[model samples]
Each structure stands twice: as structure tokens, then as C-alpha cells.
Target: MALVKIIGCGNPLAGDDGVGLKVIEELKRWGLPPGVRLISAGLPGLTILDLMRGADQVIIVDAVEAGQKPGTVIHCKETDLARVTFRSLSLHNIGIAEALSLGRLVEPEAFPRRLDIVGVQIAEITWGKADLSPLVAAALPLAVHTVYNILKGGGPYA
Candidate 1:
């Protein structure tokens, strides 16, 4: 059974870092396909592995600092994450890449069969910032659509 899980990771307290949560919010309102679970890993940090457990396919939406323009949608496979060890992912102290690497060491079989990462390039990650930047806000629809296409459409907004 292919259990597709969309894991949105971020903290609303940080500026553009919260884009992942925003994507999750909009996806929920759009009435996504049944059986496709949406998990908000709001600053999950080290607990990310637990959120993704048992998922046959996992799509992680987060904010990344790729030196690209704000609102840029970056798509990547799980393996690609390790290549950029210096670049941070999701504005966390320990990035998603590090978490996944550590998880693989602890429980190799617990990993998903397939994994994809859809990231929104961040402008800034200031604490106490509760809103997205103008450019990031404008790119919400595209972010939503990117996630939808990853699902390969099972129904509306799919």
C-alpha cells in the first residue's frame, strides 16, 4: 500500500521559513484527495523522522537557502540533499538532511521507499515574524500547484 504523506516543515515564528506551513494550510482548504495524509511538522526538528514513519512515499515541503531569488520553487530528490551539506534546509539548527541521515543510521528499514523535497527559497528567517514576504506570498499558488503535481492527482486539487 502506497501511503503518500505530505510533510510540511517550518516554524511560523520565522519569516519566510513558515512557507511550508502555509502550503499545508492552503492544501487542506482545497479539499485534496482522500487517503493522502497531510502532516504539519511545524519545527519538527529532530522529531521529523517520527512524522514520516511508515509512509511509502514522502513529499517534504520546506524553506531552503539556495541563494536563489525569493519565491523560487526548488525540487529535489532525497539524495540531493546530502550534497549540499553546507546549505541549510528549513532554517532549523539541524536541517532536514541531517535528520534524515541520522534516522537512516538508527533505523534503515523505517525510511520511506520514495522521497521528494519541494522547497521554497527563503529571503529571511527572522524570529517573531508571522507573515510571509511579498514575493513568497505571491508564490503560494505555484507552491500549492507543485505539491499537487507531486501527488499526480487522485482527485480535486490533486
Candidate 2:
């Protein structure tokens, strides 16, 4: 089991909603740190608990509809994620907030001690959409850097 786990959640077919997956794809080129595991968890609901088990810390990357400007990146800690109410009309799966809550309830000891969410404000999410909006696409590098910093011991969760 890794010490740190990075899970990217999204559906690649849903326009800008795929930012998390896209970031994971990009990260594949850079060698990851030791004791770090990367997972591209597409639309994972309760399965997030399984993926996070045994890790000391977890960083989740996902597209969020927080009504912020397109391409905005919001960093949320575990408490912040717990407070967020994920109400969306899209046909996406259960959100990170709910997943983490359930994980904590089910297995507190196996749950990660530190959880962070790097949410990129999404412009649109639709079925059969293959590409991201320009704004959301522009935020990809920023999200990647943010995650890298976290892994490097210099981000908010650090």
C-alpha cells in the first residue's frame, strides 16, 4: 500500500467534467514520488473508499460545479469536503463529498488521515462530449501543478 494516493475522478465523455482524468493522463509522463500511487477512478462513487484504503493521505482531483468562473481551481480540505453538498442535475455518479463521508462511516481506521480535493470549476458537462471547454482546458496545468505541490510537501494539506 502506498503512503499517499492520488485519485482522479471524472468521465472523459462529459466535456469539461473530464478534467480530473485529463490531469491524470498528463501526470503519467512525470515519474511519481516513492510511496505514491496514482489512480484514474472514473466516476467512482462508493468505490473511492476501496481506492483510498491503506493510504495515509489522499488527494482527489475532480470537476466541480461551484458556480465559480470557468477554470477556477478550488482546494478543499477534508472538513471542507464534508461540508459540501453535491447537488447536480448531471447523470454523473455520487460525488467525492458523499463518498468520503460514507468511507469514514464504514471504516474510519482505513480512511486516509488527510484528504484534499482539487476542484476545477466546470463550464459544461454533457453526454457524447469528447473535448473540454477552453476555459476548463486552460485550468488543467494549474491543477496538475497544484497536485504536484501537494505531493512535494508544499501544498495546503502539507
Candidate 3:
């Protein structure tokens, strides 16, 4: 099992909501430590529970309707994730947050040792295969850096 897992969850067809997928694409170039794994959900929301099982730590990236600037990025730990207020990822029937919560209640021992969420503020969530908006696109680098730092056990949010 990997020491760390990074899962990008979002829908490519939903405009800026695809930022997580975009981050995953770039991260593939950077590679990871021997005990690290990277996976893209492409809207595999609740499935996150299974992906994170047995992992020491998990970092999830997704686009969220935080009502901030288009490119704004927000960091949240497991505790924060529980208190988060988002209806759901438009592409997902049930979201990661709900799934994680359910997993904790149903089989706490199967949960990851650590869980974190890095949400990027979405501008356009309209239905289409359009690329991310320029604002959200601009935040990609920072988001990448944040993820790197988090995985390495060194970051502002870590």
C-alpha cells in the first residue's frame, strides 16, 4: 500500500469543475515518491472511499462552489471536510464528503489514516466540454504546489 494517495475528483465536461482533472494531468509529469500514488476520478465522487482505504494519507482535489473568486483555492483537513457546506459535485450523485462520513460511521477502521481536501473555486459549471476558465486555470500552479507540499509533509495547510 502507498504511504500517500492523491485522488483528483471532478467532471471534465463541467467547465472549471475539471480543475482537479487538470491538476492530475500535470502531476503525472512530476511523478511521486515510491510509496505515493496518483489517481483521477473524473467524477468518481463516492468511490473515493474505496480508493483511500488502507492509505496512510489521502489528498483529494476537486472544484467546489465556495463562492469565492473563480480561481480561489481552499484547504481542508478531515475535520474541516466534515463541516464543509457544498451540495455536491454536479457530476456526482453522492459526494466525497458524504461518502467519507458514511465510511467513518460504518467502518472506521477501513478509513485512511489522514484525509484532506483541496478545493478550487469554480467559475463556470455550465454543462459542456469546455476547458477551464482562465481564472481557474491560473490557479493550477499554486494548487499543484500545495499538493506537493502536502504530500511531502510540508505545506501551509499541513
Candidate 4:
């Protein structure tokens, strides 16, 4: 049975903000561990409830313009995320962080044991399509490694 689900959410046309999707594509090449499911979402919040209806763990990869240095990676848990004081250029209407918290409230039992966001800080968010910045692009491997380590319960930060 699938025990974990990794959802990459972003808009590919929005410059470095699309890092999540890019990572998803790159992840395909590495393949995934057994019991782990990978999916790409274009800001579908509630809709994901079904896809992750009974997952034991969930990891969300998204681009966040949190005013930090570009390419900086911020890993935060679900509860900690609720304390965030600022917003980014999210593709969803209610915001992914709020959606996940509300999702957990609606189905506590079905909620993942671990819910983390692998956020990559972006320097620019443009309207038109463009490749990811070198900095953000360089972060994909580290982001993937971070997620893997988080899944294994032994990340450097963990």
C-alpha cells in the first residue's frame, strides 16, 4: 500500500516560482521509493484530499517568495506552517498551507503522520514562461535529498 505522497504544486509559466514542477520532472528520472507516490498539482487543494485520502505521510514541494535569499530552502511542518505570518505568490485561492491545515482538521485520522513543505525561495516571479534561475535550478537535487531524508526520519535538520 502507498504510505506516502509527494505533491509538487506550482505554475510552470511563472519563472522560478515553478521550481516545484521542475523538481517533479527531475524526480521522475530518479524514480521513487516503494510505497511513495509522486504527483504534480496545479494548485488543487481540496481536490488533493481524495488523492491523499489515506496516506500515512505527505510532503509538499512548492516555490515560496518568503523574502529570503534566493534558492534558500525552508522546511516546515504543518503545525509550524500555520504560524507563518506572510504570504507568497501561491497558485491556489485559499493558500496551500491553509488548505492542508483545514484538511487535517476535516480528517485527522487520514492526515499524514508527517506533513512538510520544501519551499525554495525565489528572486523573481514573472508572468511569462522562462527556465528556472540557476540558483533555483541548483536547488533541485538538494530539495530532493531533503525530501528523501525527511521521509527516512533522519534528515540533517531532522
TM-score for each predicted model, relative to the true structure: 0.88, 0.89, 0.90, 0.88
Better of 2 and 4 by TM-score: 2
RMSD of each: 3.9, 2.6, 2.1, 2.2
Best by lDDT: 1
Q: Whole-model Cα lDDT per candidate?
A: 0.81, 0.79, 0.80, 0.76
Q: Which portions of model 4 show Cα errors greater than 4 Å?
A: 83-88, 155-158
Q: Model 1, range 1-158, lDDT digits (tens) per residue?
A: 47888999898988888999999999999877766899988888778899889898888889888878889887667777755422446357678888888998999899888777888888887889999998888888998888888778422121
TM-score of 1: 0.88
lDDT of 3 by residue, 36-131 (tens): 788998777567788887798889899988667788887778677646554346667777777778878998998777787888888888678669
Candidate 2, 88-155: lDDT as tens digits: 22444676776677778888998877888888889888778979999999998888889888777654
123 in model 3: Cα distance from truth in Å? 0.5
Candidates arranged by lDDT, highest first: 1, 3, 2, 4
Q: If both were scored by TM-score, which would come out higher, candidate 1 or candidate 2? A: 2
The pairs that clash in candidate 3 are none
| Model 4: worst 10 consecutive residues (lDDT sum) | 81-90
Q: Highest TM-score: which candidate?
A: 3
TM-score, cand. 3 vs. native: 0.90
Q: Count the backbone clashes (under 3 Å) in each candidate.
A: 1, 0, 0, 0
Off by over 4 Å in 3: 82-88, 155-158
